[model samples]
Target chain A: MKYITHSLVILLSFLIWAGTAHAVEKTSGQSRLPVTESMVNQKFIFIGNLIKRSKTFKNIEAHGDEDVFEDIANVKALYKKAELSVQQGDYEVANNLLNEIVKLVTSITRKESKVTNDQTNSLRYYNERKATIIALMKTFDEITTNEQTANESLEPRRRMVDDFLNQAKSNITNGEVDGAIVNVDKAYDVAIRITIEVRDGITLIRELNFETAKDEYLYEIDRNDSHYFLLDITVKEKKPSAKMLLSIQKLREESDGMRADADNEAKSGNYEAATDILNKSTKNLIRAIRMGGNFIPG
Target chain B: MKSGYWLFILTICLSGSGIAASFAQEYDILHPPLGTEGIYDPENPGIEYLQQPSEALSLLPSSPTGNYVDWVKAMDDSLIEPRASIYGDQIMRAISMDVIMQQTGSMPYVRFPHYDHSLILSCTNCHTAIFLPKKDANPVNMYTILKGEFCGVCHGKVSFPLTDCFRCHSSVRDKRVLDE
Candidate 1:
């Protein structure tokens, strides 16, 4: 009974974690700024996430199309470029652009937030600030884009990777293995790493770091042809965190049905339905809680 | 020096956008730093990346021991990607929540989707502070009824009008229609 209970507990947690774990792990393409050549972690990875949902956060109050200015503007423009690339079958370009937006947004937010005055009227300049979130919402309304991808209450980095995975999977299905590999490779590197020491003699100190793996991979891509994805995948070598694997598995699970639905739905010109089915397949995944007393009022 | 560099980098990022959505909004206690125009100015108090010498230097993990620096660096290095060993409470909550989201197909909790980090405003945003930087810490309050706390704070507001009871309490037993 005890062992059965424990197994149930573990499975339940994995399902929960799995929903949040899947985000893009890798970034590819020989792309450039307005997007890249910027710091991802350095940007506001989570900035304006809530602001976008703010009722007061209007897309435009006065002089413009909300998304064409400041940081929010940059994110939208970048996301737009990425989407266009994907549409045009330029996965490499899409990869770089997306990476740029994620990094730039995250990096900029952290910097701005720390310096921001947490005032009673955080919406004082509700005009400008809110505009930022609203603009991104309009431009990149993708599944995990500004509006839909707001509740980061769960594990965010994991979701970041998961979003990437979904994007990559789309590329893979279209036989864009290079593009898919580029995307997954980024996710893999970003999500895994092995510690090493350099100086006299490079001693690979044992440590699997997500940032390291990402940096090392990014470093490689940055050095060589940014488009050439180093295809040396070994799940055993890096050993994805249970969290990541679960996310991937969940995405894979939902995708099977989603793929079929997406294909047929698109054939019918139901982009919204196609997207909804795909999103629904990946979203609302918390329902997999195998019925049992994983939750007993203690 | 380490925290200073981090702050410096952070300042540049925040000025470019908004702030405190993902990490380090603990300073919200000192509310209303300045008007948007003033802080956004190149020559303002917020402009200079205040170099408060962080005591975290000692916490920095040396060549290869176990300390705060190493932990953060490891995270920076993406070392913690695979370990998803959750606790009993986390598991229970996940199970309960997943069932709720699955059934509803659309809930405030699912709207946030975890990595939506910027949505968080306080430390108690998720766990009873269970999700801390350090793994082994005091057990976050679970059973105690928290009012206006993490999930409670926004559930009724921006996240997803949590007026619907069944949206969260999965095992509420009486599965009839909820009074909106």
Candidate 2:
């Protein structure tokens, strides 16, 4: 009876060991399949969605091009093959087939020429450019009006933009889309230049009058935040030497300490003292930004 | 004693079968192992030869990070000619102007350069969409920029990242030094 019991234990142990190892192998294999299968599935869905939404595809369908239709049919058939390969655990073949489908779809949808062989596509492109130019002109008008200043210097450039826009409109009326696109581009360039000029002339002016010490302190806080932000950007851009970096770090630490002190003062209702400390902190940060290679006035 | 002998025989047979099964699982050429595909062989010269970014962008100017190339410099140097427009005939007229933002206290004012931007991009790319074409209209600050607003849209994304601060804050405050 002892011998039988010992033999039974040994047999049971072997069976359990084999079962665990097989389970582990099966699990690992299953984990790998989902990742590849999902990725291929996503690509398949994306292409299908793109085809459904594409204006180019709609145009092709309207034209009743048998060759293009046949090509699309082939893509569908290949997709099925890819799906079958995935099910059969042949991921490499499936990936290759998907890549081929992407290439075919791209080729099928691509415009034959830059101007586009389709009249509707060209008209759409022209209309988009015209709308953009009109919006830009409106923006320029609004900026000049807000400034309440006559931009005598920019008058010529503004005229140039208007002239180009008019020329583009005439070209479109004459059914010359290619020429219209060029004129519209020229108009866009001038309009942008005028907008930049008008914007650059205007400066942000803040009223320094404060109703209370707390209001002054709040203003100081915003100033400190701006300097801190500038310092961070300067440090990133400059790629300062190690020695310069150390100096900047020291200044930053000093500023941070001062800022904490100011916060404490503000909590105790010493707004005047808190503002002074915050001003010192902001100056320290300015020094750090200068050291980082931006010579901002402190 | 007879039962013990039979159990020993069965265990040996099972162990032998497991070993055979593991050997059978070993991959052959037909079902080769999956890994980092596309190993380059000089003689075979397959379609998918792997090339490092460093090797590809070796001719371009280096950035602060050794791995990245300064793409703007590469474009300026005419080492790469990217199309300005999708249409074949659209001309890119680059404007050279600097807009200085002097509202910053204690920090150097921010100076925006149009020359670099206009070289490749159309004015429409930024105007009215990313930025309103008026000063003070867009409340631009460090906090807003870091959060990916205003200049944050391209500065930290497609263009050079915002970490290079002095690039924009190039203007110095005009302080007259008194004769000591």
Models 1 onward score TM values of 0.17, 0.51
For residues A52-132, write the lDDT of model 1, one tens digit per residue. 443322332122233324766776677666656666766556666766866775555544443334332232322222233
What stretches of model 2 exceed 4 Å from their correct place? A1-69, A76-102, A107-160, A163-183, A189-219, A226-274, A281-298, B1-50, B65-68, B175-180
Top-lDDT structure, candidate number: 2
Q: Could you give the interface RMSD of each candidate, to one decimal?
A: 29.7, 15.1
**Which candidate leads the pack in DockQ?**
2
Q: Quick one: how many clashes does candidate 2 have?
A: 5
Candidate 1, B100-148: lDDT as tens digits: 1212212221222232232122212333332322222222111111233
> Tens-digit lDDT track for model 2 on B38-71?
4444333222233333334655776753235677
| Segments in model 1 whose C-alpha atoms lie over 4 Å from true places | A1-68, A115-298, B1-180
Place model 1 in a CAPRI quality band: incorrect
